[model samples]
Target: MEIIEWWPKIDPTAKEWLVTHNGEAVAPDVLTKIVAAGGSLTSDAWWIGEEGPDGFYLSDEAIDWIEATANGEKA
Candidate 1:
């Protein structure tokens, strides 16, 4: 599913973290919330970054989606 579609379902803390740390690697706990909310990590249009020892760095598209969401804009 698209991040937009499942955004509202994600935990509030996760949303806040995404907004505050826009370009940073996503924490594993937050990523869990995303997956639970139906966000896709394997989708080409969704997550598109490397998984390293630190965390998942979101793709540009993913970052844009979060920014738009924070601004109350449609995806």
Candidate 2:
């Protein structure tokens, strides 16, 4: 699955969380659904970084696929 394919499967609050904390470490469960839907940590969409004692952190691509989708672009 691609980034576009996984975006909609993500929860609304999860989307907000990613936007609000674009480069921060998040709870594993925070991205559970996303990963399950085939969101990639190594793809242009995001990357898995140092694992904190708390959990893992992720940084996504510069292009905001979520916003693009919201703006009526083809995902």
Candidate 3:
């Protein structure tokens, strides 16, 4: 699924956490939801990737999507 399509399906808390954390590793539960929604956890090209000890991080695309969502854009 597209990130925009799955963005809303994520828990509200997860959204808040991700937005607040920005470039940091996402919470495990949130990461699970993202993966289940078909998000890429291995492709740095998408800006989302799994770093060995650092965990999962969102790229500019994810961040931009969140920001647009927050601004009331409909995925």
Q: Name the top TM-score candidate.
A: 1
Minimum summed lDDT over a 10-residue window in model 1 is located at: 44-53
For residue 71, give model 2's deviation from the true position in Å: 8.8
Better of 1 and 2 by TM-score: 1
Task: Kindly list the per-residue Cα lDDT of model 2 for residues 1-75, writing each as its tens digit.
Answer: 565577678888877776666666765676787787777765554444556776666534423554455567764
lDDT of 1 at 38: 82
Lowest summed lDDT across 10 adjacent residues in model 3 is found at 43-52
RMSD (Cα, Å) for all candidates, in order, is: 1.8, 4.0, 2.8
**11 in model 3: Cα distance from truth in Å?**
1.6
lDDT of 3 by residue, 1-75 (tens): 567666767778877887777767787888898777667666445545456577766766767777777777863
lDDT of each: 0.83, 0.63, 0.71
Pairs of residues clashing in candidate 3? 47-59
Residue-level lDDT tens digits of model 1 in 1-75 = 877677789878988998999989898898899889887788875556777777888888889888987998987
Instruction: Give stretches of model 2 more than 4 Å off.
Output: 40-54, 59-75
Tell me model 2's lDDT, rounded to 2 decimals. 0.63
Q: Order the numbered candidates by lDDT, best leading.
A: 1, 3, 2
